[model samples]
Target: MEPVSLIVLLAMGTLAGAINAAVGSGSLLTLPVLLALGIPPGVAVRTNTIGILFSTFGSVYGYRREIAEEKGNLGPLMAVTAVCATAGALLLLASPGAALDVIVPILIVFALVMVIFQKRITAAIRAGAERRAARRGGAGSPATDGTDPSAAVSPGDDLSSAASIASAPTPARSPYRSPALIGTMGAASIYGGYFTAAQGILYLGVLGTFTGRSMKAVNSVKNLMSLIVNLAAASVYLVAHFVLRVEIVWLATAAIAVGALVGGYFGAHLAKKMPEWLLRGIIVVVALFALVRQVL
Candidate 1:
């Protein structure tokens, strides 16, 4: 990569990492930037996978407390996500170039829908959590989900408490029993395979359906779930592209990984400080812009 391209990639990666960490759609920025840089669509997508997977380590680690809590809850969810995501990744690898162009717009729309309902989704989760709390006499409530709605606990405390709950399970069953959960994972896998812009929204949305935790609590879950999803997809990309696109693949992967690390830190910080509304608003505007770009 030239110095200019490298610099641009770094800057984009940093912002994208932050966005992914904070909001979960940094690919909207990085992927487009890669395309603009004259990278082929397939190469760009593969490169982005590298960037996001590497970047996610930092973002997920930063929220390690939340991840730990969600890990226990993720047993079944991960199983579904892994299978679907792997299938999607393999499909993308096998698909012809013309197909991706047709698919990108649809993925963008799916992402847009996810972003639009982000707040409502989180709200529903909280409401569910509240109802669950009442049913359990406030005993088995998950303190955090994606963004905590409760006023009683600090975000930090809520995250820690939720982690505790996840680790203290009595049920031997997995959390992926819901039909809605399975369908959403399939949908999310498609979106991740086609384009990961706003995947966090899909993740958060599905998570909301299953649990009643704060958004922060859910976000923690989203990040970990995303990591698994992305990692599985990334592995497929590496295997598929290893022979034909070695140089570009390695370079793109390295750049994306580095960018993801920087972006992850900023995104996490923003997630904690920024209100859901602001993030939601940005998601809406960006989705619209992307939609228009696709349609026009």
Candidate 2:
């Protein structure tokens, strides 16, 4: 590659890494930049994945504390994600890109809509869950003073009740483990492996809606899951490159990877200070831009 093109790749990769750490979908920026610079589409996609791997590593390191705290909850999900992601990567290697071109825009729009109304959706789910709990309580015990059962616990029972709640079975323990949520996450991983653009948005929506965790926590998990998907897909790409003699732009990859590493470190710090709404807005705007670019 020419010096100018290398410089451009580095700059775009840096910006992409920062955006990815803050809100995700940074590939939307780097992939197009790579294509516009005259790289073959196949090589560009592989190189971008390799470059973004460094960004994800940096983001994970930045969020190490959060990730460690959530490791128990994330263990099963991560295993499932890795298996599904590898399947998606194999599908990508076998399928034609055009097959997903039409579907991807629709998926992006749906994710944007979900992000826009996430608060309302989450509120509704919470209300529904509470109502169910109330009903269950009413069925087993008659009301004594018209007080809420949750508030009627005796002082001696408080510790036990809290412990029971904490130790509930995984599925009933949290909305994050619901069947719907697990399915959504599985789908998101598959898509992430197959076509990485705007994947972070999908992950954010899934994690935000179901996990009942703060954005920082969700972002930490997102970074880990994305790292798994990229690693799996990159492995497939490497094998195919050797078997099919696919070209890879090593110089371009090195430039972008170095930039991504720097940007991701700073971006993780930025995420700690970013407001939720600001991050959501940025995700929606960038996803729309990518959708439009794909369509036109």
Candidate 3:
């Protein structure tokens, strides 16, 4: 590679890594650059996966505090994601690409919509949970002055009711670890392994909706999960290069990896300071751009 081309690849990789660490779909930025530089599509994708492994490592290091807080919740899901991602990578290695072309755009659109309405959806979920708890409490309480138990509580007593709810015994298992969440995560991981564009956005939507984690915490988990998926896929590509004699552009991979490392560290720190609205807005705009680009 010429010095000028190498510099351009590194610059693109840095920006891609930062975007990925902060939100996701950094491949949207880097892959096009690689193609423009005359790298073959398959080689570019595989090389990019290798580069992302480094970027994600930096992101994980930057988000270590948040990761530590959520480690217990992340353990099982990580295993599921890794295993499913490997499967997806195998599929990618064996199959032709046309099948997913249509599906990808639709999924991206859905992910964008989920991000946009996340707050409202979460609020509705909380309201439903509260209503259920109120009904359960009402059933056991004795009526006084012929008043309905649910309606009998005064506004001032709401705090006490909430306190009682808080003091209720916690379940041994978190609802976040339910089969549905696991299945959804596995599916997303598979998609990530096969086609990575906006995979982080999909992860954010899933984690935000199901885990009810704060955006920062969810993004932290997103980085880890994405790392696992890319790592697994990259491993497959590495094996293919060795065993099947597939070509890999080592210079491009090195450039991206080095740049991504720097960008990931800074992006993680930046995300920590970003306001929720701004983070959400970035996710929406980037996802939409990715979606349109993919369709075109």
Candidate 4:
């Protein structure tokens, strides 16, 4: 690639890292640049995975507080995600390249639909959680309300009344193992293997089951999860490149790592201040761009 092209790749990687940290679709930036620079599709996937690894690190560091609190549960989740991702990466290597052209577009389309339904899904989960909490109140647990049972109503009445009280918006909670987490990790591994843009959104949508955090908190976990999966994928890619000896296409992976580190930090910081809707809007726009680009 020309120096000019390399420069463009670096810029794109940096931006991708930042946006990825911010809203979860950094691949759209790097992949096009890779293809534009004349890298083969298979090689591009490997290098992009390498580059995002740094960004993942940066984002995780930036969100360390949130992660520290949730660290106890991360081991099992990361183990599952990493193993599944390794399998996905191996599958990518074994499959024929032309096969990806057919598969990738479908994955992109499915991800787009998933993005559209993200909110409704979250809302439904929140509602279901509220209902369960209400039922639990019948056991004489503290109602979400602060009032004491002895002060006013009977425990039975308080329990029933808890059902009538306005549902508190569920805060994003700490991470733990769950069926949702397992399924999401599996799905994300598949997505990571195929089309990786906005993979964070899909993971977060599922991780929502265990966490009731703000977007920033969720993003921290997202970065941590992405780091685990991308690193596992990168290991497979490294073996494919070295052991299988695919041609070296470009040298921007290290730079992507550096840029992503910086970008992820900022992305996490910005997510704290940015409204969820705006961040989400940015994500939808990027996802649409990725979908259109893949289709065209």
Please report the candidate that would top lDDT against the real structure: 3
- Give the per-residue lDDT of model 1 (tens digit) for 69-188: 546556766787788888877777777777766676576666666676767666776577568657776454455344444655666676878768656868655444566666777778
Off by over 4 Å in 3: 97-168, 270-296
What lDDT score goes with residue 119 in model 3? 61
Give the lDDT of residue 235 in candidate 2.
84
Any idea what lDDT model 3 has?
Answer: 0.74
Q: Mind giving the per-residue lDDT tens digits that candidate 2 earns over 121-233?
A: 65676566558767878776746445575564566777877779767876545455566667778888888887676677678767776666665568888888888888888
* Best of the candidates, TM-score: 4
Q: Going through the candidates in order, what is the number of backbone clashes in each?
A: 24, 0, 0, 6
lDDT of 3 by residue, 40-132 (tens): 455666777887678898888888898787677667788999999999878767654455455545655655665567567656755665687
Ordered by TM-score, highest first, the candidates read 4, 1, 2, 3
lDDT of 3 at 143: 62
Tell me the TM-score of model 4: 0.73
| Per-residue lDDT of candidate 4, residues 21-94 (tens digit) | 76576776666566555555666777888887788888777778878987886777778788888888888787
Error of 1 at 273 (Å): 3.0
TM agreement with the true structure for every prediction: 0.72, 0.71, 0.71, 0.73
